[model samples]
Structure formats: structure tokens, C-alpha cells
Target: MKYVTRTCYLGQISILSVAITLTCVSPNVVSAATPTLGCDDSMKTAFKPDGNTTVLLVKKVKKDDPYPSPSKEQQIFPNRPARFAADLCWVKLLVGPGVPGPTGAPSTSRGIGIEVWLPEKNAWNHRVHALGGGGWANGYEETVVGRMSVGNGNLPAPRIAAEEGAVTATTDSGQQYAGASFAMNPDGTVNVAGWRDWSYRSLYEQAVKTKALATAYYGSPPNYSYFEGGSGGGRQALHVAQNLPEQYDGIVSIRAGASTTSDIAQLYPELLVLRDLGGKAPSREQLEAVSAAAVAACDIVAGQHLGFILDIRRCRYDPTKDAAVLCRSDGGTNGTPTCMTSAQALVMNKVWYGLTIDGSVPDPALDNGWDAPVTGVRIWYGYPRGGYIRSLQGDLTWPEMKSGGPDIIALALGNPKIGTPDFKNATANGEDGWKTLTYAELAAAYQSFRAMQSETGGDPDYNSDLTRLKISGAKLLQVNGLHDPSAWVQGLTEYYDRVMAKMGGPASVQAYYKMFVVPGMSHGYFSGAANPNANPPVPADGQLYRALVDWVEKGVSPDSMVFTSPAPGSESSVYKIYPHPHGPQMSLPACAYPTVATYFSGDIFKAQSYKCR
Candidate 1:
């Protein structure tokens, strides 16, 4: 929680800030030196593992090792591939084995598995960066641990950090073996220890141990630390900032995931709407068409037909009654193969408005109020109408269903643990789970999940106070793509607003934290035209990482971020789109919250043409 002071001076300060006064003296790190320690088995003894943490493995990855070290190198990464991580010492730990977590939680037979990759001695950057896992995955998927995984997931966070000369680590939070199944015991009891590990304990231990081991090797503690992640990983990043400020000096949380209750509540509405269709759901093309129509209707600025909508809230064209989308038989004029039927439009309408009874966000507010029945209650906000509805529509077909709505219901119903028969029996017949469930049952499950948010999901932790971080001299940079569907934009904005309320207001919060929204970007996945007429989706590059480093080091706050789409014939690489104003890039200006890149004049492809107003 300490920083190397540069200089602190006082002057006429606005009542809103002394927020700035404190921020001025904090620089990310001034390293002791690049420390080098031998990388080998002997280092295991040198680690001096403490508490219930046991160092299980320590090895060096020689330079030119195929990055990520896949089971089969060609399976995921092939050809010239990703940045080959070289010259590093890899370490793994079994943390808090058989340990009972907080709240008198029962002890687990297994311990949390954590992996750390530190650059070789002279290569060490004197900084520690931890990666967060997606979904139920922590960081590492190691067999040394007992429970495998809730979903056997891992992210590229640690690898990327090691590549950057950082001492990095990821904790599997004891989910490496059992995946999502770890939450439910064989006898159908909730695994409170496992839940605690995944949600809270694992990350805390990893930070303490990762730093301890780094100090062991480096002969000095790191001057600064950072954590960056997107999606579930993003949630972990926030968790550290909120619960363990001493862990990292800078946090870049992108498209952070919501609570389990929010996840179930937000997804159920779509499942319900589709289930009611009785196998008569709209085709993928129809869903895409309506999504396109929403963009087409909303992307206009002044006289210009801008590519993407700056503010979706202002774009009120509803598909259910829109003239351009409805088929002639149902009402309107469009005769294209993609025209929507009344039924299809109804589905879109439900998805847009979400499953709210009073048009409030469906996400449960943190309180005793959430323990009641979910009927006629707000669940969470709808997926904003964008991202080509690709992730959603592909999930529409029962045979190839991709959404986790049914599973969420199962998990939620188990409250405080995976309910025994319900987890298996409900989702047993696949989509039939959606067919047979009664509204009352669904509501009860939603209620159950909401109540369990503290133990299972990091809702209380993730959404709680940041006074610790704000005062820690740390900086926060959060980004969300305007077109992202995996994580809710409205939800993120609401979280920011909540933080603002907790920290006084936007001005006070902005002193040490900032958020940016990318236009035409979606979950860092697609990189082509989502709607050809609108700005195409593009990959999010590491430019934000540089911004975070500079912000933490030089106090240069980002007032605006530039988002880019590949221009025709542009070099087919990410860097061409990054570092700003590279060759033939079609980019847009992405401003800080409450401000959007408004088109002023000139070529739409030029970011300079738009101003943050």
C-alpha cells in the first residue's frame, strides 16, 4: 500500500480535490534493481513457504519455449504464434490445504493451486502482476490440487505478465479439479470452503505468497504491482483492489463479470421468452436483422449516418413495433429473408427490456430484500442491442444451445451450495430444463442465488467499498466495449455510479480512477464488421496497459481512448491498429464516462473528426 514519493506540493486546491493532492505524490514504482536468483529446485527450499501454503514445483522455462506450453503445441497456438515467453522461473503452490475459510466454513480436503512465473534474475522487473481467471476458472489448472475445476478454465493473464518482465501468478481457488462441480459435494451439500476459496480466500493468499516468493528470489520486494483482466478475470482484478489493496498499485478491469445472481437473473428472461415460443423461436438471421435495424436506427448523428450509436439509451427504436423489421404478414413492409415475425419481434422486445417487472435492472441489490421471491422483481438489465447478437442468437437453437441459463438456475437453486438433485435433474434433459420449470420454481432459485452472493459470487466483495483502494495511492482504469454482449455495459456503468456514490461523486472518484467505453468492440473477440454500415468490431490492443503504467508512474490520466477498426488493406496485425495513428487505420474517439465521441466533421474513419463532448 506504499509508494515511492516523488514530490508533493500544495496550492489552491478545489474542495473536490486534495483527491488530486494525494494523487500527485504517487508514482507506480522506483525499482531497487533487476534482481537475479538462480532458477532451479533448490529455490523451492529458498522460498520458505508459510502458513498452509506448500511450494509444490519450481522450474525454469528457457528462452524460446513455446508460449503457454500447451498439451499439444499446435492445438491452440501454432505458426509464428503468440509472444514466446522466455527466461522465466515457474512456481506452483498448494495454498491453505484442508483449511477452513472465514465464517466457520468447513475445511476442504483440497487446497488452492496457484502458479507464479517470474522472469529470471537479471530479467526481473521488480514488479508483480497477477492474472484473474474467467468463469469458474481461477488461474492454473494443475493436477497437484484435488478438485479440478467448476469449468476447468484458465486465462492468459499470467503468461502475458511474465512476457512483460513481471513476477506474475494465478490461483485456481481450489476449482482446478472439480470445476463448477466443486461447489456441490457428493452428498449434495454446499462446499463452503470451496466457495470461499474461489470467491475470496484464493486471491488474498496468492498475493501474499506471490510477493513473498518474489522477495525471496529478488532479494528485495517489488516497488509496484498491477493486475489486469477482462470478463471474470476483470472481476478478480476488482476484487483485489477492493479487498486486498496491498496486492496491486494499478488495476485495469475490463468488462468485469456481475454476480451469480445477476448472471442467472439476466439470462433467464431470454430463456423464458424462447421457451414460451414452443420451439418456434426466431431464426438467427432474424435476430441479427433486428439488431442491425437497431443500429441503423440509432447510429445517426446530426445529418451524418454514423457507424455506431454513441448512446444506446437515447436510441429508442424498439424492434417489436419497428416498421423496417416486421414482416408484411405480421404488419410492416420489409420482405427480406431476415424480416422479423411478430413472435421474433416479441423475443427481441423481451431481451431489450430484460426481465424486469418494474423496468428496473434485474440485478439484485445487496440487502436482506433479495432473500424474497423473485416473481415480479427486477432481475438485471437486458443485453444491450448490439454485438450482432452473435453470442446470444447462436445460443437460441436448442440443439446447439450455448447460453448457461439452465445451469445458472440449477446453481442458484442450490443456494449456499449446489442443490443435490436439482443441479442434475433440472438440466438433465438439456433444454427441457427450460420447458418444465415453473415460474415459481425459477423465482425461488433466483432468490436462493441472490442470498448466496456473499459466499459464492464476489457481489458483496466486488461491489462493496473502494475507500481502501482510493486511499492506497493506486489508480484504476476500467474499459468496456459499447457493443460488448458478454458483460453488461449498463451494469458496469451502474457499478461506477455506485462507487461514485460511495466516494462522494464522479469528481472525487475520477481523481484516482477512470473508465472508458470502446465503440465497435465486443468482449475482445470479433474483429470485423458486426454491422457493415456501422464501425466494424476490432481487437483491443495493449495500448491501455501502457496508459495504466504511465498513469501510475507519471500521473497522466487518460481523458480519451482511441478505438480502431482495420481499414481495408491495412496490415493484418493488431499493432497496426495500436500505438495510435498507425497506417490506414479506421479509428474512433472513445471518451471517459458521461462523455462520448461525438462526430464533428470530416472522414468518419479519422478519430480526429470526433470530439469527446
Candidate 2:
């Protein structure tokens, strides 16, 4: 048999081939032999929910075949897997008239792109895995068809659900993977529907149709359904757990940027501090020195000796205490490379002390209440000694450094001075678009965007309806990296506490949901000491998806899991390696909340040397 490739108008050739033949049944039509049908037809099934929805294509993908995007311009990452096999279904959803099209122009169809991948009959595992995306962007089809199913972070062969023999799906949420292009139309009007799709609707709609497609393909419903993602994907998982508890059996969020409110509160304060210390920002070496000194001072402060502080809450190591070593005697310039300038010291101290304007603390007060005598700022990143301070790019202008460059920032700060052109260009190039707005204006804009996200379900309040999830018997596992620079660890800790307070208590929350804190690990994966190229495999340590499956199918919950760090200078390290007192490769058993990993002597590099206390 000869196979030919064809490209769609959007210039995308799905990772799952549209050429492979499939035997499909039309909606409302039934046949037993449909399960054994071949992929010769394109439109084997038609799903039209209303006048607005349309099922564009349905085809079977054969195993061990090459599948790539239609154009090289597509931003799909990593690479295609060695063998791609699945039943591919494509649908175009309508968000009503006046909805912006791909070019940000008006169109009636308001085409919301959605794709689903199902394992071929022989490889079907009777389960479903839905993937997620990062930043303020919608879930991407590139992820669904991309090499890694769980995500690129857990990649390097095996883990992408389809390859593991489960059904998978992703949607553009009425927009492409291009950051926040869909947030605002060219006319500067808010794309409410696009925001809806980005927030919760896109995932909601795709999950619904995915189940029906699964049943239609296999002739029976899946035994289990799950979601796996990191960062923004984690936020989406929380959204599903709250809004659509019935669709999934299990869900896991890795290093989740769960609260937009916190992002708004702390993001600007850090930017402001850096803004004041222009040309005197701390170098990477200085940042590492601060982290090392902090760890050294706090290592045994609260009955813990470790690579990274296991529980930052109990350990209150002050950076200012080591100011003599950190600050230059002259307080001008020409000091030791390990020390901070007076200006740099002031900025660092302010960053540590979270969001404050004119000595007045902001609402939803900083979550660093555990810090005894809480000296300065004590923000999220300030808690853990090596909490990714080096990751902050302060070289950029104040405007560029704000909000870490999310497209949603553009929408929020876009006013008369910094209009659509600036927003669009700022996203493309690292332009200092915020200079156009006054301090008051910028503050107002941030609040506005934060409110919009909250109302639209983007900035989740952590007040998720977990009771509904518990009632439905669904399982949720939230794994947070102690050194996550983007999301505040203290904030997340507080949110978990609120869950316990709102619900019954730790036991009640634990029955349905579990939060695990990874020691020594930074955002995504890896500790400061691990090599970016040689970092340890995340799943090898956490077994996230596998754990979810066990809990959903066998009623088992993850307690203590040993996670390893990638070796120095290895191919697996995807991020930069910072200095830490620990060895090149380290392992630790991350424990559930209220319990910390206590050091017990002997071969500190191995996880078995320590016990979860």
C-alpha cells in the first residue's frame, strides 16, 4: 500500500495521520463491526452539537509511521516519536458570530480547533490521558501529538499517553499556541469567548467529545480518565477538578502556577525592586552565593540537614544576617564577586520582603507568616534558599520584566499610551511596553487583568469545589517544587491550609486530594546542582501518572516517593545548574504535607539515607 501526505489550509499535518483508514460509525448510527473498520474514509463520523459545531475529519493512524506538522513554522517542540499510532479525530467548534478568527479578524465560524487521539484496538489500555500547556495559553494540539504525552518535561521516549496505549486529546481553546494573541482582537476589544476557551471551556468541551469519540471507536467507554500537566497545565487540572469533576477519574498537576492573584501580587514587587537597582542587579554567582550562605545558616536550624530546605516553613534563615559577607565594605563598587552592592542589597532585601506600597501591605497578605520576626519581604522565591532567583532576567527594562512576559500582561496594561500595537510587538520582541503607563495606571491594569482572570476562572482562588470531587470519588495529586520561582511556595502552602480549614481537615482533604512537596527540586524538574542536560527523569522519581492510575483503579495513594536529580553535564538537563552544597546527583523522598524529610545520616546522596518524618 502506498501512503501520501496532504497538508491542511492551516498548514498542519497532525502527528496522527489523516491518511490511515478507519472504520467509523456516524452519530446516531450503530454497528457492531464498526470496531473492526479500516481508516479508508475521512468523514467516518459526524458530531454536530448545534449549528455552531462541526466534525471536520476522522481517520485512523497506523503505527511505526512518520507524522510531522504540515509546516516548519509550527512551534511544536522536542520531536515526533519513533512510532505514532492512533485514531485521529478533528473538530471545529463555533463560538458564535463576531468571534475573532485565526488572524484576529472577525469570522462567524469562530473556529475552535480540537483534536483527539485514541490507541488502536490492539494497543488500547482502556484508559484516557488528556495533556496541558504552559503560560496564559490554551492547550495545544502540538502537545497531544507531540512526542511526550505527559509533557516535554517528562520526555525522552515513553510517557505520552498514546504511545503508552491510552486515548489522548488537546484543544487550542479557540486560539493557537501563540501566547496571548487571541486575548484581544485587532480593534482592542476583549475576546470574551477566547478567554473562556483559554480558561476552562476548551478543555471542558474537548473532554466531553473525547469520551463520546472513545466509546464510538472502542464500542465501550474507558475504565479510567486522567489529566497530566505542569505549570499552566496544573492550573487547568485544578479547574477541571473544580468545574467538571465528573469527567476525570484522576488528575495531577506538577509545579503548578495555581494562583494568578499571587502572581499579580508578587510579580510587580520583584520587578519594582529590580527596577530601582538598575545596572546593579545581583549576578548569577552572587545569587548562588546568597543561596549557599542561606542553606549553610539554616541547614541545622530547625533539626534538618539537607541539600535544600525540606520545609521552608520551619527554617527561617535570614539573608540580611549574612549581609556583611554579601555587602561590600565600600558600599559603592569594586567589591568581591560574591557580595552585593548597597543598591543590590536593598533590592534583594525588598524582593525577600513581598509586595508593599508606601509601607502598606496589599490584600491577600504575603503567605510568609511562618517566618519568625519576618524581617524584610519574605516572598515565595525568598523562602527556599535557591528558589530560582537566578532565573529572573532583570537586564530587561521594568516594563519587559513585569509579569514575566505573559500575553495576558499585554491585555491588562494596554491603554491609550500602550495600545494594541505595543502589546502585540511587546509579545513578539522583549519591548518595554509598560513605560507608556504611569505607576497608578499599571497598578490598575494589573488589578483589572487579575479580576478578569478570576471571573473567567483563569486565576483560580484555590477554593476549588473539592467536596464534589470527593463525592464523585475522583482523585487529585498536586506536586509542587520547593524552588519554583514563578509560583510562590508559601502561597500554595497557605492555599492547602485553607482547603483543610474550609473542608474538614487534613484527613478530609487527603481522602480525595494529596499535595506533595518536592525537596531540592526547582520548577519543572531538577535541583540547583543537577545538570541541565543530565537531570534525572521526573517520572523515575515521582511516577506521577502511574501513581494516579493506581489510585484511580486500585485505590492506592502516593505517600513517600524518592525523586532523583540528573547527573552533572548529562543530556537530560534542560535548564541551567546552579551551585548547591549537595553532590552532583541527589535523591530524596518527598513527603506529604505536615511531614518533612528528616536527615538520618549515612550516604546523604541516596534517598534511603533519609526518612520522611
Best by TM-score: 1
TM-score of every prediction relative to native: 0.79, 0.78
* lDDT (Cα, tens digit) per residue for candidate 1, span 94-126: 765544433322223457788887777777777
Best by lDDT: 1
Q: lDDT of each model, Cα atoms only?
A: 0.58, 0.54
In model 1, how large is the Cα lDDT of residue 343?
A: 70
Candidate 2 residue 512 Cα shift, in angstroms, is: 0.5
